[model samples]
Target: MPKIKDKAIIIGVDAVLPALLAQGVSPHFITSIDPQKLTYEKIADSADQIKDVSLIAAPYVTPEVHKIFPASNIFWTFSTKSIESWINSMLEGKILTSGASTCAHLNLTAAIMMGCSPIIYIGQDLAFPEYRDHAAGVVLSDPDQIKKELGVTNQNTVWLDGVSGGKVPSTRGFLSMRNHLEHIMASNPGPHYINATEGGAHIAGTEVLPLQEVIDRYCSETIEFPSRLHTALQDSNLSNTKKLLSGLNKALNDTKSLSKTVNKYDKLIHSILHYIRSENNNGAARSVSDLPILLQNKISNAESLEKKMDNRKHLYIWQILGEGTMEDVKKSECSLHEITILAKQPENFMLSFTKNLERLLSLNKARKNILAMFQHRLLHIINFHRKEKIILKKIEQKKNMEQNLFELAQFYFETGNLVLAQPVLEKLLALNPDSAEVLFYSGAIAARQSKFEESEGYFQKAQEADTAMSKRVLEFRRGLGGIYFDLAGIQEDKIYSNLSRKMLFKGIRYCSNHPKIKQEIIYLAESDLTRIKSALESGTINDVETILTVWHKGLEENKNLAPCITDDQIAGFHRHYGELLLKKGDLDGALKSMQAALKFTPDNPDLYATAAELFFAMQDFTNGITHLNKAVELDRSYAILWENMGDHLLQTGEINDAIAAYEQGFIAIPENINLLKKIGDCYLENGQLEAAREAYKIVKEKYELAQPPRT
Candidate 1:
């Protein structure tokens, strides 16, 4: 990486910043995309090394990222549909690309957009090559590692093409990410991408060359680019600066005015709600007609204000606080036409809409504050500096208002009013996108709504952001695990099972310091594994995929949990697979299952007996007798095995052999009446009248002796 800094324009993600900084390779631009504090903390921890580097952060990044870095060097990445991108397209400056979700994907997008030739990918090892997540200098915490390792069980862990040609362990996330990068490479075939990690998972679309070889082949000459890069940046960026400055100035004022109006609407909605439900009905005896008319007028005013916030100036707040009144109206009604029946709706919808308005205003205020921060950094670099002093003075800012909105949101969230709290948190996220408290609540809300993956991401970010909330976060995680656990118990849904097991796995990991909690969570997880295994064995759940999935998960989970799962238990799961296949009448599948089971326990008589059963189901009487003979040899006293061998022989017309097998069965169990009857049947079939008569007479006497008396 250091070798290519001088030869090529180096760009990377937030995760690589520490590695880049440690090696003294100042990236031209280090971009951030995840709304994770750990993502921002990596940048914060490398503050000293990042002075000369520009930061191109997405709008979803935390405000702390915006604080330490200057706005002049901090370019924001926006969606192509965004007004900022539209303005950039019209202006003479750097136009950023909206890559696929990951930072490395974004780096590729940027590299492709810049017309860079032979773009090389380094530090993109999407696998645990050495049983480690990343190379040196990347500080991945324990909790997140537990979470990532959730699905990568011993049974299901993916083995992909290794950089040095052997297979390596990887998770689904890394595989998906690699797929995305490969797709980008495949779609845009112009620039050649080189994967020079030389270890970890191999990428399909990249040239697998070592770093030194890449340098020798393409970077033999040291090209001077720093000056040209800075020159090109300065040449065509002045026009966009003024337009942005003017928009910021106007946006600051708009938020203050917008906030007061939303607050007013909040009070009115409560008043109207109270009146609508009141027995006296505002003491006016008013019909429904008058109220709907009043509501329509209020709705129009609120819609007008919301529409005003939906423009270019308020893009951050508008985009962040999505699902405005229109979404609310739709959710409140069954159809578009029923949106007109707003008056007939419950107060919850009204409160939700008003909450949306209030939080939108809160987001507007947050935007106001953020714009001031932007103006503080950008004011010095602008042509509008002559008007900057007055403009900065007129940036009507009250910091506590944002906090008050957060408090309001917290109250609603805590009281189980997610509809009201959701918009508020969305607003707060746009304000302080990575606050540990806000992120935790956001995750909690997502969990309640069954957005398990999104919830996990938020919880992980919250855990990474603040160590102070460690205990609370741990408790919350247990609660989340319990939710999945309960759902898994009641419904055999694969989604719930996967989620529960993963969270329980994380619980076992994160609560490692808390021995009691760790014990409890592991027991819960282990119990669930047993539960699924029991279900499979009982033939209650017969879906082949479900059976196999549970089988794999149980092995992995039990292995991870102090090797609680025994060889017998694992063999049982495998044997149950054969049992399920047998139950489904899949003779070939059941045979294959028994064959696999025998690999684990070749000496176990039960597996051979199972193979004999499958052979009987397959109607191969010869192999069936052979497998039963093997079972009897392994366990001479297994009466069922002896009896089964006699039955198979008799069915194949080997009467003498059948009679001898029945004698062996009677020897195995001396009080066996069934074997005596089988011997009589075999003797009779062989036309030996005296032997058949004697065997039948003995069988009749024993059968009569074993019979119960009539009541």
Candidate 2:
């Protein structure tokens, strides 16, 4: 292996990073995918050991992990999510796609993308051999190190054909990983795939040999990989730095920033939680349809935010960070029944949704911070490419220097480099304290930095300095409004609410031409305001559920007054309410609501799914399957729904229909290999011995690929 250490561009996933570093093998690149902070904690002890290794990361990677790596060293890795194609056009970095879920698969993917040949898999055990999960250097968490929790039993276990000729015990997860590796090898031609781990389950489509022997044959000569890669990266970063800087700057400068999406979705999830809690009150509102109106922004507003990005869906970032919220937003509001039935799972669904949103909120906020870090680093990179004579010498005059430095401060401020922009803006204020642009920027900077009093003074001064600076003053006031607004959400204090309203009203009054800062949205915010002020004036009560209830009620009541609300949105509200009512056992209410919804737009798929499950649970198989068929006709990708249909059919002596539904379920979700066994059982029950035998055979082969527990 030492003979060609320089020849290969070895890459390791975060799983194998510690072991590799311990072995003194400095891999050129590392891959990371898991979103949990645990993914970062796993190899954090070795942060110093791998500062130079490039990170190939998905946007879902925990922000902590991104922070540990050098800003210039990190590159994007994706899980094949449908990111808006325009995202690639904005960055010059080479985007790498990682296979789903496993460390080894991602490593292999990273290697192949780097033009590596004869891909050798080392310690690639698709089985937990001898009940040992990892090699000597790796320290696993306590739960992961335990065996029985994996549900591996002798009866449940399937044996795999091993590399050294004996059978190996394996599990469903490792078996899936093995198949994924095989698929990659099959699809990508010209890479000589070799498995160097002489123990563990055998991988098809690869030659198996001992590591030493494979190295002896393949590593006869050395090639300079480090300098080659370093040179290539230098060229890429230099060419792309300035262009990417502009995009990053614009994103941070956005008022309808990604934060708006976060605020909207956070409210939606909270509104759902509140609605579930309010159901017992018997009088939360006559408008139980508040949910869908609250839900309207999850899709429409998010798409609006994306379109506002130069009128394009530029926020593929949401696809990465805000998975739960984005998934809801991606679906049509009326069809989002995935979490609609809260009456059955109020606590569980609320906890899961809130936790997921919390993670997404952290990740989204983290991305902005990450982009700021990237922006700061890119500025440094751009400086390296600057022609000193052209850039510095020409701006040497006092006046010219002030203008140039002010522009430079604006760049820094726009991309959220407040720390750097602080000193520059201070210098500009020193040069021209009365400059409205400079004062307005100072006010914004102070507001974001939480110096609210100082920010207020700066905004007042800026306004006084130039009576014509209404738009900038309006924006400055809005910034102040946002800070107070957030504080109000956290503390639920009337002081913060009043202050927020004061700033928002000031913004609206100063720039009446700005269409978005309407009295309706302000009143909507008032509906969200405390019992003291907004509640006193608008008669909208303040409490968790009532605050949200009135908020949507305001949106609905002002539909004719506000451009944002419409008739279709109101219908979507009824659909969601009916969908939940079906689950809640209010059949008459559901039928009325459903009919109202159908009148606006007939044959809603979510309505069909809700009714189908309701009927299935009530033992009305004939009607259940009929509704299931209609739902499946509208959307065939719902595997669990298909399984529900199959289970109902199997229970009612419809063997043929049962088998067909199970097959469709299997087609919809190929990950659950156990579905094949269910199909086999149905075939056997129907006395089709040969068909059962074939289906069971395939299931057995896959099931046997891993041990019960991955040691």
lDDT of each: 0.63, 0.60
Where does candidate 2 have its weakest 10-residue lDDT segment? 541-550
For candidate 2, write residues 115-152 as lDDT tens digits: 78889988888887756566654523222233443455
| C-alpha lDDT (0 to 100) for residue 506 of candidate 2 | 33
Please list the residue runs of candidate 2 whose C-alpha ends up more than 4 Å from where it truly belongs after superposition. Answer: 1-4, 48-52, 69-72, 82-87, 94-99, 141-144, 150-158, 237-239, 248-323, 326-711
The clash count for each model shown is 0, 9
| Model 1: per-residue Cα lDDT over 1-711, one tens digit each | 778788888887876777787897878878777764335445544653454577777766765455433322666666664544544644454665545678888788878877987888776777765445555665332222433464555454788888888887777778888998888888889998888886888888888888899889998777666677678778853565556666554544655555555455545545555445553433342233334666657656656755664556556644433333345434433443343354245543543444444444444444445434544544443433444333334433544656766776766665455545677788889989889999988887665443546766888888889977667777876664554334233343333333344434433332334443344444544454466566776666543344354455444444343343455555656666667667777789778777766766788987887787778667786886677767777887666766776888889998897888788778767698889988988888899889999999998898888899889
Q: What is the C-alpha RMSD of each candidate to the true structure, in Å?
A: 17.3, 32.6
TM-score of 1: 0.44
